[model samples]
Target chain A: MTDYIVPVLLFAACAVALRKKENAYDLMLLGAKDGLKLLVSLIPTLILLLTAVTMLRASGAMEMLSRFFAPAFSVLGIPPETAILVLVRPISGSAALALGADLMAQYGVDSLVGQTAAVMLGSTETTFYTISVYFGAAGIKKTRYTLPAALIADITGFVVASLTVRLFL
Target chain B: MVMSWIFTGLLALSLFASLVLGNGSALAAAVPQGARDGVNLVLSIAGSICLWSGVGKLMEVVGFTGFLSKLLSPLLHRLFPSTRQDKDLGQSLSANVCANFLGLGNAATPMGIQAAQRLAKRSEGIASDELCRLIVLNTASIQLLPANVAAVRVSLGCQTPFDILPAVWITSLCSASLGLCAAWLLGKVWRR
Candidate 1:
């Protein structure tokens, strides 16, 4: 069912474009051009955020952070491995993906740890990155309360994913 | 922005810590590698954003966005009250949510940015409460497919990659709801 979404949307879009007598090719190119512009503006922000995040991860800061958070997370039924993914998930999707994949590979995907990682990955977004790029692009200087709100949401996702694994898996 | 400062601090601290902790080589490798990853990240989503944004334009041309806006207006109004008068904002927000629902966040991202820009048009340089809520919604987007995670599972030879759908749904919905509530409450409090 999930696999069919793209194909279904593609067909719908083409059909609608044809029905409306809009030049599908031109419209797509126009959008692609806009996307290019948007992506270009985002590059600087992405580079800075990614550089910091990647450096943090590669420098083993996450390991220290994970160790610090491990005891608290364990109280909530989360393992140390999953704790790293949860912490990184809000900062960078690629990092979270790599950690999630590592978790699945290290512990079978069906295991509780792997399952928790998968659910959390699916449920949350890269909050800080999203705030930066989106707000940065829109030229909004003050982002009051948005960070804390999004982080609250991320924590909920992590807690819920852990509980979901415990109850459902 | 504060985020810039935070990232700068984090990078400097990490580099300093790595140098002191004997992991300088990893940090050294990460600098160039991070730039490459940033480009790769953009490239990875460029095609998806292009395709989705195209589909979005077509949806507008074909009046599908109107239909969608009407269908989702009740809920959209509750979340974004200003959308009641602004069809364009409603349409873009609806498209963003639609893409998110399909687990196409990379696709939804351009739409989310579009919506944020639209919302910002009515305000000064500072973002409005509604715009902040929209950003919060996008960050806590509720995914229906969880396709990427499932794909990773499949690659790892999991028998049922999509088995976590219920978990994803429950967690995402809860978080999104709670996040929205927090945004709304905080927006009201901070405004006064």
Candidate 2:
């Protein structure tokens, strides 16, 4: 969060410092306006994610799926709670965040599951949603190498998350 | 439009899948509930994502991006040394990088657009830098520690919510490194 504060100021400073008097105020205003549009565009997406996550938790997918995933992860030293994270990480980023929060709450952050979720958070990409929004917005009809590449990166993150937590936790 | 439709359909499919997975014997009875719940879930997630996106934009308005640029300047220089100084592309890259790190991805959308705008200017309509390259770069794997993730850990009542240092460092290091390498390779191929 500390890293976040100054960048907001950078927009105004960059506009004021770099642009002419005529352009400075104008560009900043345009940016501000576009910023709002950007925000507005994402509402439906967020609402959908939250609803799905809540429903899943209510549905007992959290408990049932954890059992299935626990044995698989034991080989990697990851606790089962972290399994829910890997499940949601791909489909919905917000859900994953919520799930991680729940895991943190019950298991405690010092626990291996909590630690693994933290690492997993930083490591992986939000594959389906990001691909859809980014490329869809750009009118990119095809991803070509992008899909495989993103997956490889995701696998690497999963492995590293497990390995690091196992070694350190 | 096609992609959107596909995604919507997939959401529906995932919902059905969840319903069946949960209620194999009572599929007909449960399907409707699952469908309604799934739609509601998607809507909620959409709202939250928009909220975070709004916050991220507010972040830009208040000048948080510039500071992030300076702070992450060293890493940016090392990662993408080819990017020029005094260019918004670098700033945009830094912004995207920062958003990814915070797991404020919906927020990173604007930064990606900004970076693309900069890249477009740098290429001067030559298509030399092709659009996908920016996407790949923006999609770079990030390393998050004391983030929404740590908050989750804390809420879950973990002893140390910030106990993910090892995983954060190692996983992010590998994923981001691989992302950069593959992206660079793809960029080279595109250039040819």
Candidate with top lDDT is 1
C-alpha lDDT of residue B3 in model 2 = 35
Q: Cα lDDT of all candidates, in order? A: 0.77, 0.57
Residue B153 Cα positional deviation in candidate 2, in Å, after optimal superposition: 3.2
Could you give candidate 1's per-residue lDDT for residues A1-169 as a string of tens digits? Answer: 6446556877887787887788887877776686677668766766666666677777887567778888999887777767767766887676576667656766788998899989999899999889998898788987888898998888888888899888987
Angstrom error of the Cα, residue B177, model 2: value is 0.8
Docking class of 2: incorrect
Candidate 2 residue A133 Cα shift, in angstroms, is: 2.6
TM-score of each: 0.69, 0.59
TM-score between candidate 1 and the true structure: 0.69
Write the residue-wise lDDT of candidate 1 on B39-129 in tens digits. Answer: 6655655655566666655655666645654676789888888888888887778888876775545557888888899888888668788
Off by over 4 Å in 2: A1-81, A105-109, B1-64, B67-82, B99-107, B117-133, B140-146, B185-192
